[model samples]
Target: MNLIDFLFLVFATLAVGGGLLMIFSRHPVSAAMFMIISMVSVAGLFVLLESFFLAILQVLVYAGAVMVLFLFIIMLLDVGPEGSKSSKIKLLSGLAGVVCFGILMVFSLILVLNSYPECSSCAVWPTLDDNNLVLGQSLVFSTSVKSFGFGLFSKYMLPIQVAGFLLLAAMVGVIILSKKFVREGNPS
Candidate 1:
Protein backbone atom coordinates (compact mmCIF):
# COMPACT_ATOMS: atom_id res chain seq x y z
CA MET A 1 0.00 0.00 0.00
CA ASN A 2 1.01 3.63 -0.51
CA LEU A 3 2.29 5.87 2.34
CA ILE A 4 -0.86 7.99 2.13
CA ASP A 5 -3.04 4.91 2.46
CA PHE A 6 -1.01 3.72 5.42
CA LEU A 7 -1.28 7.11 7.11
CA PHE A 8 -5.01 7.26 6.45
CA LEU A 9 -5.48 3.82 7.99
CA VAL A 10 -3.44 4.82 11.04
CA PHE A 11 -5.36 8.06 11.53
CA ALA A 12 -8.74 6.41 10.99
CA THR A 13 -7.98 3.68 13.51
CA LEU A 14 -6.80 6.22 16.08
CA ALA A 15 -9.89 8.33 15.54
CA VAL A 16 -12.30 5.42 15.96
CA GLY A 17 -10.38 3.80 18.79
CA GLY A 18 -10.10 7.05 20.70
CA GLY A 19 -13.79 7.76 20.26
CA LEU A 20 -14.78 4.30 21.54
CA LEU A 21 -12.37 4.63 24.47
CA MET A 22 -13.76 8.06 25.27
CA ILE A 23 -17.32 6.75 25.28
CA PHE A 24 -16.55 3.75 27.47
CA SER A 25 -14.15 5.49 29.84
CA ARG A 26 -15.36 5.68 33.43
CA HIS A 27 -13.36 8.75 34.46
CA PRO A 28 -14.36 12.14 33.08
CA VAL A 29 -10.72 13.27 32.69
CA SER A 30 -9.78 10.12 30.79
CA ALA A 31 -12.80 10.51 28.53
CA ALA A 32 -11.81 14.11 27.78
CA MET A 33 -8.23 13.09 26.98
CA PHE A 34 -9.48 10.34 24.66
CA MET A 35 -11.70 12.86 22.92
CA ILE A 36 -8.66 15.07 22.36
CA ILE A 37 -6.82 12.14 20.85
CA SER A 38 -9.76 11.49 18.50
CA MET A 39 -9.88 15.18 17.56
CA VAL A 40 -6.15 15.24 16.77
CA SER A 41 -6.49 12.09 14.67
CA VAL A 42 -9.37 13.66 12.76
CA ALA A 43 -7.19 16.72 12.16
CA GLY A 44 -4.56 14.44 10.69
CA LEU A 45 -7.18 12.98 8.39
CA PHE A 46 -8.13 16.51 7.34
CA VAL A 47 -4.46 17.19 6.58
CA LEU A 48 -4.43 14.08 4.41
CA LEU A 49 -7.50 15.41 2.60
CA GLU A 50 -5.32 18.50 1.77
CA SER A 51 -7.51 20.90 3.68
CA PHE A 52 -4.72 22.52 5.70
CA PHE A 53 -6.83 25.40 6.97
CA LEU A 54 -9.50 23.02 8.33
CA ALA A 55 -6.83 20.72 9.75
CA ILE A 56 -5.23 23.58 11.67
CA LEU A 57 -8.57 24.81 12.89
CA GLN A 58 -9.52 21.29 13.97
CA VAL A 59 -6.34 21.02 16.02
CA LEU A 60 -6.38 24.52 17.46
CA VAL A 61 -10.09 24.85 18.13
CA TYR A 62 -11.15 21.30 18.97
CA ALA A 63 -8.11 19.49 20.34
CA GLY A 64 -6.63 22.49 22.12
CA ALA A 65 -9.10 25.21 23.08
CA VAL A 66 -12.31 23.21 23.28
CA MET A 67 -10.62 20.34 25.07
CA VAL A 68 -9.13 22.72 27.61
CA LEU A 69 -12.55 24.24 28.17
CA PHE A 70 -14.12 20.79 28.60
CA LEU A 71 -11.36 19.71 30.99
CA PHE A 72 -11.85 22.89 32.97
CA ILE A 73 -15.57 22.27 33.20
CA ILE A 74 -14.98 18.71 34.33
CA MET A 75 -12.57 19.77 37.04
CA LEU A 76 -14.72 22.70 38.07
CA LEU A 77 -17.72 20.44 38.42
CA ASP A 78 -15.64 17.97 40.48
CA VAL A 79 -17.03 15.05 38.50
CA GLY A 80 -16.21 11.60 39.80
CA PRO A 81 -16.14 8.16 38.21
CA GLU A 82 -19.43 6.88 36.90
CA GLY A 83 -21.44 4.34 38.82
CA SER A 84 -22.10 0.99 37.16
CA LYS A 85 -25.52 0.45 35.59
CA SER A 86 -27.59 -2.65 36.30
CA SER A 87 -27.21 -5.55 33.85
CA LYS A 88 -30.82 -5.31 32.69
CA ILE A 89 -30.52 -1.60 32.01
CA LYS A 90 -27.20 -2.07 30.18
CA LEU A 91 -28.65 -4.93 28.11
CA LEU A 92 -31.70 -2.92 27.11
CA SER A 93 -29.63 0.13 26.17
CA GLY A 94 -27.18 -1.98 24.18
CA LEU A 95 -29.99 -3.69 22.29
CA ALA A 96 -31.64 -0.36 21.55
CA GLY A 97 -28.33 1.09 20.31
CA VAL A 98 -27.72 -1.90 18.01
CA VAL A 99 -31.25 -1.73 16.60
CA CYS A 100 -30.93 2.02 15.94
CA PHE A 101 -27.57 1.52 14.24
CA GLY A 102 -28.97 -1.26 12.07
CA ILE A 103 -31.88 0.88 11.00
CA LEU A 104 -29.58 3.79 10.11
CA MET A 105 -27.25 1.53 8.16
CA VAL A 106 -30.12 0.06 6.15
CA PHE A 107 -31.47 3.52 5.42
CA SER A 108 -28.07 4.72 4.26
CA LEU A 109 -27.57 1.63 2.12
CA ILE A 110 -30.95 2.22 0.45
CA LEU A 111 -30.02 5.82 -0.28
CA VAL A 112 -26.70 4.77 -1.76
CA LEU A 113 -28.33 2.09 -3.91
CA ASN A 114 -31.06 4.40 -5.15
CA SER A 115 -29.79 7.92 -5.79
CA TYR A 116 -26.75 9.97 -6.71
CA PRO A 117 -27.79 12.82 -9.04
CA GLU A 118 -31.38 12.23 -7.98
CA CYS A 119 -30.46 13.05 -4.37
CA SER A 120 -29.73 16.75 -4.95
CA SER A 121 -32.27 18.90 -6.75
CA CYS A 122 -31.59 19.88 -10.35
CA ALA A 123 -31.52 23.57 -9.38
CA VAL A 124 -28.84 23.25 -6.70
CA TRP A 125 -26.70 20.82 -8.70
CA PRO A 126 -27.73 20.70 -12.32
CA THR A 127 -24.85 18.59 -13.55
CA LEU A 128 -21.51 17.16 -12.42
CA ASP A 129 -19.72 19.42 -14.91
CA ASP A 130 -17.02 21.80 -13.64
CA ASN A 131 -18.84 24.66 -15.37
CA ASN A 132 -21.77 24.22 -12.94
CA LEU A 133 -22.27 27.30 -10.77
CA VAL A 134 -21.70 25.60 -7.43
CA LEU A 135 -18.78 23.43 -8.60
CA GLY A 136 -17.21 26.25 -10.66
CA GLN A 137 -16.98 28.63 -7.75
CA SER A 138 -13.85 28.18 -5.64
CA LEU A 139 -15.79 29.61 -2.68
CA VAL A 140 -17.75 26.38 -2.18
CA PHE A 141 -14.77 23.99 -2.20
CA SER A 142 -11.62 26.05 -1.62
CA THR A 143 -9.58 25.23 1.49
CA SER A 144 -7.79 28.59 1.71
CA VAL A 145 -8.26 30.60 4.91
CA LYS A 146 -9.29 33.76 3.05
CA SER A 147 -12.04 32.04 1.04
CA PHE A 148 -13.31 30.23 4.15
CA GLY A 149 -13.38 33.44 6.19
CA PHE A 150 -15.13 35.34 3.40
CA GLY A 151 -17.76 32.65 2.86
CA LEU A 152 -18.32 32.22 6.62
CA PHE A 153 -18.77 35.95 7.19
CA SER A 154 -20.80 36.71 4.07
CA LYS A 155 -22.90 33.74 3.00
CA TYR A 156 -23.11 31.82 6.28
CA MET A 157 -23.22 34.66 8.77
CA LEU A 158 -26.65 34.29 10.35
CA PRO A 159 -26.39 30.54 11.00
CA ILE A 160 -22.92 31.00 12.48
CA GLN A 161 -24.16 33.77 14.73
CA VAL A 162 -27.08 31.63 15.80
CA ALA A 163 -24.79 28.74 16.62
CA GLY A 164 -22.57 31.03 18.66
CA PHE A 165 -25.60 32.33 20.57
CA LEU A 166 -26.74 28.74 21.20
CA LEU A 167 -23.35 27.83 22.59
CA LEU A 168 -23.38 30.92 24.79
CA ALA A 169 -26.84 30.02 26.06
CA ALA A 170 -25.66 26.50 26.88
CA MET A 171 -22.66 27.92 28.75
CA VAL A 172 -24.93 30.24 30.72
CA GLY A 173 -27.24 27.36 31.55
CA VAL A 174 -24.33 25.28 32.79
CA ILE A 175 -23.07 28.09 34.99
CA ILE A 176 -26.53 28.69 36.37
CA LEU A 177 -27.09 25.02 37.07
CA SER A 178 -23.71 24.65 38.78
CA LYS A 179 -23.95 27.84 40.81
CA LYS A 180 -23.51 27.27 44.53
CA PHE A 181 -25.99 29.37 46.49
CA VAL A 182 -24.81 30.27 49.94
CA ARG A 183 -27.91 30.80 52.05
CA GLU A 184 -27.59 33.90 54.25
CA GLY A 185 -26.66 33.04 57.92
CA ASN A 186 -27.91 29.45 57.86
CA PRO A 187 -25.61 27.20 59.91
CA SER A 188 -25.89 23.48 60.69
Candidate 2:
Protein backbone atom coordinates (compact mmCIF):
# COMPACT_ATOMS: atom_id res chain seq x y z
CA MET A 1 0.00 0.00 0.00
CA ASN A 2 2.71 2.48 1.07
CA LEU A 3 6.17 3.06 -0.53
CA ILE A 4 8.05 1.40 2.33
CA ASP A 5 5.71 -1.58 2.24
CA PHE A 6 6.17 -1.89 -1.52
CA LEU A 7 9.95 -1.73 -1.19
CA PHE A 8 9.86 -4.38 1.54
CA LEU A 9 7.72 -6.66 -0.59
CA VAL A 10 9.98 -6.20 -3.63
CA PHE A 11 13.12 -6.95 -1.62
CA ALA A 12 11.50 -9.94 0.06
CA THR A 13 10.35 -11.36 -3.28
CA LEU A 14 13.80 -10.81 -4.82
CA ALA A 15 15.50 -12.51 -1.86
CA VAL A 16 13.23 -15.56 -1.93
CA GLY A 17 13.22 -15.87 -5.70
CA GLY A 18 16.99 -15.56 -5.91
CA GLY A 19 17.42 -18.11 -3.11
CA LEU A 20 15.20 -20.56 -4.98
CA LEU A 21 17.12 -19.96 -8.19
CA MET A 22 20.37 -20.55 -6.33
CA ILE A 23 18.99 -23.82 -5.00
CA PHE A 24 17.72 -25.18 -8.32
CA SER A 25 20.14 -23.80 -10.90
CA ARG A 26 22.12 -26.42 -12.80
CA HIS A 27 25.12 -24.18 -13.46
CA PRO A 28 27.46 -23.60 -10.54
CA VAL A 29 28.37 -20.05 -11.59
CA SER A 30 24.74 -19.18 -12.24
CA ALA A 31 23.83 -20.54 -8.80
CA ALA A 32 26.59 -18.47 -7.21
CA MET A 33 25.30 -15.34 -8.95
CA PHE A 34 21.79 -16.10 -7.73
CA MET A 35 23.15 -16.59 -4.21
CA ILE A 36 24.83 -13.17 -4.39
CA ILE A 37 21.59 -11.61 -5.56
CA SER A 38 19.74 -13.25 -2.65
CA MET A 39 22.31 -12.07 -0.15
CA VAL A 40 22.11 -8.50 -1.47
CA SER A 41 18.32 -8.58 -1.27
CA VAL A 42 18.47 -9.87 2.30
CA ALA A 43 20.91 -7.09 3.17
CA GLY A 44 18.41 -4.61 1.73
CA LEU A 45 15.72 -6.13 3.95
CA PHE A 46 18.00 -5.74 6.97
CA VAL A 47 18.43 -2.08 6.07
CA LEU A 48 14.65 -1.75 5.85
CA LEU A 49 14.44 -3.28 9.35
CA GLU A 50 16.84 -0.54 10.57
CA SER A 51 19.49 -3.12 11.52
CA PHE A 52 22.47 -1.39 9.89
CA PHE A 53 25.04 -3.52 11.72
CA LEU A 54 23.36 -6.73 10.68
CA ALA A 55 23.10 -5.53 7.09
CA ILE A 56 26.81 -4.73 6.90
CA LEU A 57 27.71 -8.05 8.54
CA GLN A 58 25.52 -9.94 6.09
CA VAL A 59 27.19 -8.32 3.09
CA LEU A 60 30.74 -8.52 4.46
CA VAL A 61 30.54 -12.06 5.81
CA TYR A 62 28.20 -13.82 3.40
CA ALA A 63 28.53 -11.90 0.14
CA GLY A 64 32.21 -10.96 0.42
CA ALA A 65 33.99 -13.84 2.19
CA VAL A 66 31.81 -16.93 1.95
CA MET A 67 30.82 -16.25 -1.67
CA VAL A 68 34.48 -15.69 -2.59
CA LEU A 69 35.27 -19.11 -1.13
CA PHE A 70 32.38 -20.67 -3.05
CA LEU A 71 33.40 -19.06 -6.33
CA PHE A 72 37.03 -19.98 -5.72
CA ILE A 73 36.04 -23.61 -5.31
CA ILE A 74 33.82 -23.49 -8.39
CA MET A 75 36.60 -21.98 -10.51
CA LEU A 76 39.75 -23.57 -9.07
CA LEU A 77 38.25 -27.04 -9.15
CA ASP A 78 37.58 -26.74 -12.89
CA VAL A 79 34.15 -28.25 -12.39
CA GLY A 80 32.42 -28.71 -15.72
CA PRO A 81 28.74 -28.28 -16.47
CA GLU A 82 28.33 -32.01 -15.90
CA GLY A 83 29.50 -31.53 -12.29
CA SER A 84 26.06 -30.15 -11.38
CA LYS A 85 24.18 -33.24 -12.47
CA SER A 86 21.81 -34.89 -10.01
CA SER A 87 22.48 -38.47 -8.92
CA LYS A 88 20.20 -41.46 -9.52
CA ILE A 89 18.74 -41.07 -5.98
CA LYS A 90 16.93 -37.84 -6.95
CA LEU A 91 13.42 -39.19 -6.26
CA LEU A 92 14.23 -40.17 -2.68
CA SER A 93 16.01 -36.89 -2.09
CA GLY A 94 13.08 -34.93 -3.49
CA LEU A 95 10.61 -36.82 -1.30
CA ALA A 96 12.75 -36.19 1.78
CA GLY A 97 13.04 -32.51 0.91
CA VAL A 98 9.28 -32.17 0.47
CA VAL A 99 8.58 -33.89 3.79
CA CYS A 100 11.09 -31.68 5.62
CA PHE A 101 9.62 -28.55 4.05
CA GLY A 102 6.08 -29.66 4.96
CA ILE A 103 7.09 -30.20 8.60
CA LEU A 104 8.84 -26.84 8.76
CA MET A 105 5.85 -25.07 7.22
CA VAL A 106 3.48 -26.68 9.73
CA PHE A 107 5.69 -25.61 12.65
CA SER A 108 6.03 -22.08 11.29
CA LEU A 109 2.27 -21.79 10.72
CA ILE A 110 1.61 -22.95 14.27
CA LEU A 111 4.09 -20.43 15.66
CA VAL A 112 2.61 -17.61 13.58
CA LEU A 113 -0.96 -18.48 14.50
CA ASN A 114 -0.42 -19.06 18.22
CA SER A 115 2.40 -16.80 19.40
CA TYR A 116 2.77 -14.00 16.88
CA PRO A 117 3.36 -10.56 18.33
CA GLU A 118 0.66 -7.91 18.19
CA CYS A 119 1.57 -5.14 15.79
CA SER A 120 1.62 -1.65 17.34
CA SER A 121 0.83 1.52 15.41
CA CYS A 122 4.07 3.05 16.65
CA ALA A 123 6.98 3.34 14.21
CA VAL A 124 9.27 0.28 14.42
CA TRP A 125 12.38 2.44 14.86
CA PRO A 126 11.83 5.58 16.89
CA THR A 127 14.76 8.00 16.68
CA LEU A 128 17.37 8.07 19.50
CA ASP A 129 15.24 5.92 21.82
CA ASP A 130 16.46 4.45 25.11
CA ASN A 131 16.14 0.93 23.76
CA ASN A 132 18.27 1.83 20.73
CA LEU A 133 20.92 3.39 22.95
CA VAL A 134 20.90 0.28 25.16
CA LEU A 135 21.26 -1.95 22.12
CA GLY A 136 24.22 0.13 20.90
CA GLN A 137 25.90 0.00 24.32
CA SER A 138 25.37 -3.74 24.54
CA LEU A 139 26.89 -4.33 21.12
CA VAL A 140 29.93 -2.18 21.97
CA PHE A 141 30.67 -3.31 25.54
CA SER A 142 28.46 -6.32 26.19
CA THR A 143 29.37 -9.19 28.52
CA SER A 144 28.54 -11.54 25.66
CA VAL A 145 31.22 -10.16 23.33
CA LYS A 146 33.68 -10.12 26.22
CA SER A 147 32.79 -13.72 27.02
CA PHE A 148 33.21 -14.63 23.37
CA GLY A 149 36.69 -13.06 23.36
CA PHE A 150 37.65 -14.92 26.55
CA GLY A 151 36.32 -18.17 25.15
CA LEU A 152 38.44 -17.62 22.05
CA PHE A 153 41.50 -17.08 24.25
CA SER A 154 40.98 -19.72 26.94
CA LYS A 155 38.40 -22.49 26.54
CA TYR A 156 38.41 -22.92 22.77
CA MET A 157 41.83 -21.48 21.92
CA LEU A 158 43.42 -24.75 20.96
CA PRO A 159 40.46 -25.71 18.79
CA ILE A 160 40.57 -22.32 17.10
CA GLN A 161 44.30 -22.69 16.43
CA VAL A 162 43.71 -26.22 15.18
CA ALA A 163 40.98 -24.99 12.90
CA GLY A 164 43.42 -22.59 11.26
CA PHE A 165 45.91 -25.44 10.92
CA LEU A 166 43.18 -27.65 9.49
CA LEU A 167 42.34 -25.00 6.92
CA LEU A 168 45.98 -24.90 5.90
CA ALA A 169 45.94 -28.70 5.72
CA ALA A 170 42.85 -28.53 3.54
CA MET A 171 44.59 -26.18 1.15
CA VAL A 172 47.43 -28.69 0.92
CA GLY A 173 44.93 -31.50 0.44
CA VAL A 174 43.18 -29.62 -2.35
CA ILE A 175 46.48 -29.09 -4.15
CA ILE A 176 47.41 -32.76 -3.74
CA LEU A 177 43.99 -33.91 -4.92
CA SER A 178 44.09 -31.70 -7.98
CA LYS A 179 47.64 -32.54 -9.00
CA LYS A 180 48.52 -35.28 -11.47
CA PHE A 181 50.51 -37.76 -9.41
CA VAL A 182 52.29 -40.82 -10.73
CA ARG A 183 52.53 -43.94 -8.59
CA GLU A 184 55.66 -46.09 -8.47
CA GLY A 185 53.92 -48.86 -10.41
CA ASN A 186 52.25 -46.58 -12.91
CA PRO A 187 53.70 -45.13 -16.15
CA SER A 188 54.39 -41.40 -16.17
Candidate 3:
Protein backbone atom coordinates (compact mmCIF):
# COMPACT_ATOMS: atom_id res chain seq x y z
CA MET A 1 0.00 0.00 0.00
CA ASN A 2 2.62 2.50 1.13
CA LEU A 3 6.01 3.10 -0.51
CA ILE A 4 7.89 1.50 2.40
CA ASP A 5 5.65 -1.55 2.29
CA PHE A 6 6.16 -1.89 -1.47
CA LEU A 7 9.92 -1.62 -1.13
CA PHE A 8 9.88 -4.08 1.75
CA LEU A 9 7.91 -6.63 -0.29
CA VAL A 10 10.19 -6.26 -3.28
CA PHE A 11 13.38 -6.56 -1.31
CA ALA A 12 12.05 -9.46 0.78
CA THR A 13 11.09 -11.37 -2.35
CA LEU A 14 14.50 -10.74 -3.88
CA ALA A 15 16.20 -11.91 -0.69
CA VAL A 16 14.22 -15.13 -0.41
CA GLY A 17 14.50 -15.93 -4.13
CA GLY A 18 18.20 -15.27 -4.14
CA GLY A 19 18.65 -17.41 -1.02
CA LEU A 20 16.81 -20.31 -2.66
CA LEU A 21 18.85 -19.97 -5.82
CA MET A 22 22.03 -19.87 -3.76
CA ILE A 23 21.08 -23.08 -2.00
CA PHE A 24 20.04 -24.95 -5.13
CA SER A 25 22.59 -23.71 -7.64
CA ARG A 26 24.82 -26.43 -9.09
CA HIS A 27 28.00 -24.38 -9.13
CA PRO A 28 29.57 -23.35 -5.84
CA VAL A 29 30.80 -19.99 -7.15
CA SER A 30 27.39 -19.21 -8.64
CA ALA A 31 25.81 -20.15 -5.32
CA ALA A 32 28.14 -17.77 -3.54
CA MET A 33 27.20 -14.99 -5.95
CA PHE A 34 23.53 -15.68 -5.37
CA MET A 35 24.19 -15.65 -1.63
CA ILE A 36 25.74 -12.20 -1.99
CA ILE A 37 22.65 -11.06 -3.85
CA SER A 38 20.47 -12.44 -1.04
CA MET A 39 22.56 -10.70 1.60
CA VAL A 40 22.32 -7.37 -0.21
CA SER A 41 18.59 -7.77 -0.68
CA VAL A 42 18.16 -8.51 3.02
CA ALA A 43 20.23 -5.45 3.80
CA GLY A 44 17.83 -3.42 1.64
CA LEU A 45 14.92 -4.83 3.62
CA PHE A 46 16.66 -3.80 6.85
CA VAL A 47 16.95 -0.29 5.44
CA LEU A 48 13.24 -0.32 4.60
CA LEU A 49 12.52 -1.39 8.17
CA GLU A 50 14.52 1.63 9.38
CA SER A 51 17.04 -0.74 10.97
CA PHE A 52 20.09 1.03 9.60
CA PHE A 53 22.43 -0.54 12.14
CA LEU A 54 21.36 -4.04 11.17
CA ALA A 55 21.41 -3.16 7.46
CA ILE A 56 25.02 -2.04 7.58
CA LEU A 57 25.97 -5.00 9.74
CA GLN A 58 24.33 -7.36 7.24
CA VAL A 59 26.30 -5.85 4.38
CA LEU A 60 29.62 -5.57 6.20
CA VAL A 61 29.46 -8.86 8.06
CA TYR A 62 27.62 -11.16 5.65
CA ALA A 63 28.55 -9.62 2.29
CA GLY A 64 32.00 -8.28 3.06
CA ALA A 65 33.41 -10.81 5.54
CA VAL A 66 31.47 -14.06 5.25
CA MET A 67 31.00 -13.98 1.48
CA VAL A 68 34.64 -13.11 0.91
CA LEU A 69 35.63 -16.02 3.12
CA PHE A 70 33.36 -18.29 1.07
CA LEU A 71 34.89 -16.99 -2.16
CA PHE A 72 38.38 -17.45 -0.80
CA ILE A 73 37.66 -21.04 0.18
CA ILE A 74 36.03 -21.73 -3.18
CA MET A 75 38.99 -20.30 -5.05
CA LEU A 76 41.53 -22.03 -2.83
CA LEU A 77 39.89 -25.40 -3.35
CA ASP A 78 39.22 -24.77 -7.06
CA VAL A 79 35.81 -26.40 -6.79
CA GLY A 80 34.01 -26.16 -10.11
CA PRO A 81 30.55 -27.25 -11.17
CA GLU A 82 31.89 -30.68 -12.06
CA GLY A 83 34.10 -30.87 -9.02
CA SER A 84 31.85 -33.22 -7.04
CA LYS A 85 33.72 -36.34 -8.10
CA SER A 86 31.98 -38.49 -5.50
CA SER A 87 28.69 -39.90 -6.72
CA LYS A 88 29.04 -42.90 -4.46
CA ILE A 89 27.09 -41.36 -1.58
CA LYS A 90 24.59 -39.41 -3.66
CA LEU A 91 21.55 -41.57 -2.98
CA LEU A 92 22.15 -41.72 0.78
CA SER A 93 22.76 -38.00 0.98
CA GLY A 94 19.67 -37.28 -1.10
CA LEU A 95 17.49 -39.41 1.17
CA ALA A 96 18.90 -37.67 4.23
CA GLY A 97 18.21 -34.26 2.72
CA VAL A 98 14.64 -35.23 1.86
CA VAL A 99 14.01 -36.49 5.35
CA CYS A 100 15.42 -33.35 6.89
CA PHE A 101 13.38 -31.16 4.56
CA GLY A 102 10.21 -33.05 5.42
CA ILE A 103 10.81 -32.64 9.15
CA LEU A 104 11.52 -28.91 8.74
CA MET A 105 8.43 -28.45 6.59
CA VAL A 106 6.27 -30.15 9.19
CA PHE A 107 7.72 -28.07 12.01
CA SER A 108 7.33 -24.84 10.04
CA LEU A 109 3.75 -25.71 9.19
CA ILE A 110 2.98 -26.30 12.83
CA LEU A 111 4.52 -22.95 13.70
CA VAL A 112 2.40 -21.20 11.10
CA LEU A 113 -0.74 -22.98 12.18
CA ASN A 114 -0.36 -21.37 15.59
CA SER A 115 -1.50 -17.90 14.59
CA TYR A 116 0.81 -15.22 15.97
CA PRO A 117 0.13 -11.62 16.84
CA GLU A 118 0.11 -8.88 14.23
CA CYS A 119 3.51 -7.65 13.06
CA SER A 120 2.67 -4.13 14.22
CA SER A 121 2.28 -5.43 17.76
CA CYS A 122 5.99 -6.14 17.91
CA ALA A 123 8.09 -3.61 19.80
CA VAL A 124 9.75 -1.37 17.25
CA TRP A 125 13.40 -0.36 17.42
CA PRO A 126 14.24 3.31 17.66
CA THR A 127 15.16 5.09 14.43
CA LEU A 128 18.57 6.63 14.94
CA ASP A 129 19.95 9.72 13.20
CA ASP A 130 22.83 7.87 11.56
CA ASN A 131 23.68 4.19 11.21
CA ASN A 132 27.09 4.55 12.87
CA LEU A 133 25.68 6.48 15.78
CA VAL A 134 23.04 3.81 16.23
CA LEU A 135 25.68 1.09 16.24
CA GLY A 136 27.81 3.09 18.67
CA GLN A 137 24.84 3.56 20.95
CA SER A 138 23.93 -0.07 20.79
CA LEU A 139 27.46 -1.16 21.61
CA VAL A 140 28.21 1.43 24.28
CA PHE A 141 25.01 3.03 25.58
CA SER A 142 23.83 -0.23 27.20
CA THR A 143 20.57 -0.07 25.27
CA SER A 144 21.33 -3.17 23.26
CA VAL A 145 24.59 -4.39 24.68
CA LYS A 146 23.30 -4.63 28.24
CA SER A 147 20.28 -6.67 27.30
CA PHE A 148 22.37 -8.66 24.85
CA GLY A 149 24.93 -9.42 27.51
CA PHE A 150 22.20 -10.33 29.94
CA GLY A 151 20.72 -12.81 27.47
CA LEU A 152 24.11 -14.13 26.42
CA PHE A 153 25.37 -14.63 29.94
CA SER A 154 22.15 -15.77 31.54
CA LYS A 155 20.40 -18.06 29.06
CA TYR A 156 22.81 -18.40 26.14
CA MET A 157 26.21 -18.72 27.76
CA LEU A 158 26.61 -22.42 27.09
CA PRO A 159 25.61 -22.06 23.45
CA ILE A 160 27.99 -19.15 23.03
CA GLN A 161 30.88 -21.09 24.53
CA VAL A 162 29.96 -24.13 22.42
CA ALA A 163 30.05 -22.00 19.28
CA GLY A 164 33.45 -20.64 20.23
CA PHE A 165 34.72 -24.13 20.85
CA LEU A 166 33.35 -25.31 17.52
CA LEU A 167 35.10 -22.49 15.75
CA LEU A 168 38.36 -23.34 17.47
CA ALA A 169 37.89 -26.99 16.56
CA ALA A 170 37.26 -26.07 12.96
CA MET A 171 40.49 -24.09 12.82
CA VAL A 172 42.41 -26.99 14.31
CA GLY A 173 40.73 -29.46 11.99
CA VAL A 174 41.69 -27.38 8.95
CA ILE A 175 45.23 -27.15 10.15
CA ILE A 176 45.40 -30.92 10.71
CA LEU A 177 43.90 -31.69 7.30
CA SER A 178 46.26 -29.34 5.49
CA LYS A 179 49.28 -30.49 7.47
CA LYS A 180 48.86 -34.05 6.22
CA PHE A 181 49.38 -33.00 2.60
CA VAL A 182 51.96 -30.36 3.39
CA ARG A 183 54.19 -32.88 5.15
CA GLU A 184 53.89 -35.32 2.24
CA GLY A 185 55.42 -32.84 -0.21
CA ASN A 186 58.33 -31.64 1.94
CA PRO A 187 60.54 -34.25 3.61
CA SER A 188 61.66 -31.70 6.21
Best by lDDT: 1
> How well does model 3 score by local distance difference test?
0.79
Q: Across residues 100-185, which tens digit of lDDT does each residue of candidate 1 receive? A: 98999999999987876554545642322323223345545555666667777877899899999999999999899989878889
**Per-residue lDDT value at 134 in model 3:** 29
Off by over 4 Å in 2: 83-88, 117-132, 135-188
Clashing pairs in 2: none
TM-score of each: 0.72, 0.65, 0.59
Per-candidate Cα lDDT values, in order, are: 0.85, 0.80, 0.79
Which is the leading candidate under TM-score? 1
Clashes by residue pair, model 1: none
Summed backbone clashes in each candidate are: 0, 0, 0
State the lDDT of candidate 3 residue by residue for 33-75, as single tens digits: 9999999999998777655667888999999999999999999
- Root-mean-square deviation of candidate 2: 5.9
Model with the higher lDDT, candidate 1 or 2? 1
How much is 36 displaced in model 3, in angstroms?
A: 0.1
Model 1 clash number: 0
- For candidate 3, report its TM-score: 0.59
Ten contiguous residues minimizing lDDT sum, candidate 1? 125-134
The clash tally of candidate 2 reads 0
